[model samples]
Target: MVSKKVTVKNPTGLHLRPAGILCNEAMKYQSQITFVYDGGMANAKSVLSVLGACVKCGNEIELTCEGVDEQEALDHLVAAIDSGLGE
Candidate 1:
């Protein structure tokens, strides 16, 4: 498993659209992926779960991936977030 913290830089935070982008990115990998914010954790592949995380702009989130392609999954997800999900 691998984990890294990334701040949400999108002005609107992890709203529906960006969260959907994240979910789409996560679905490209076989690894199990999750996002941790505050004391809550949400499945990265689920838009509803991500929205439930209540993340806002500037929030720090911990992304974790586990399974065969953990490293690649982590890298992609982190890149997605860092790129503002192409906002």
Candidate 2:
């Protein structure tokens, strides 16, 4: 398992567009991608789950990936989030 802390940088947070982007990114890998925010855990590959977390801009989340490609998944996800998830 691999995990990294990242802050949501997009102004609108994980709304529909950004959340959809996040989910699409997560679906590329076989690893299980998830994030913990506000005491709740969300499946990164699921747009509804991410949106349900209500992660606002500036909120910190611990992204986790576990599976055969955990490291790569973690790195890619962290980078995506760092890049503002395409804003």
lDDT of each: 0.93, 0.93
What lDDT score is found at residue 53 in candidate 2?
Answer: 98
Report how far residue 44 has shifted in candidate 2, in Å.
0.4
TM-score of each: 0.97, 0.97
Give the number of colliding residue pairs in candidate 1. Answer: 0
TM-score of 1: 0.97
Candidate 1 structure lDDT: 0.93
lDDT of 2 by residue, 1-87 (tens): 989999999998999999998999999999999999997999999989999999999999999999999999999988998998886
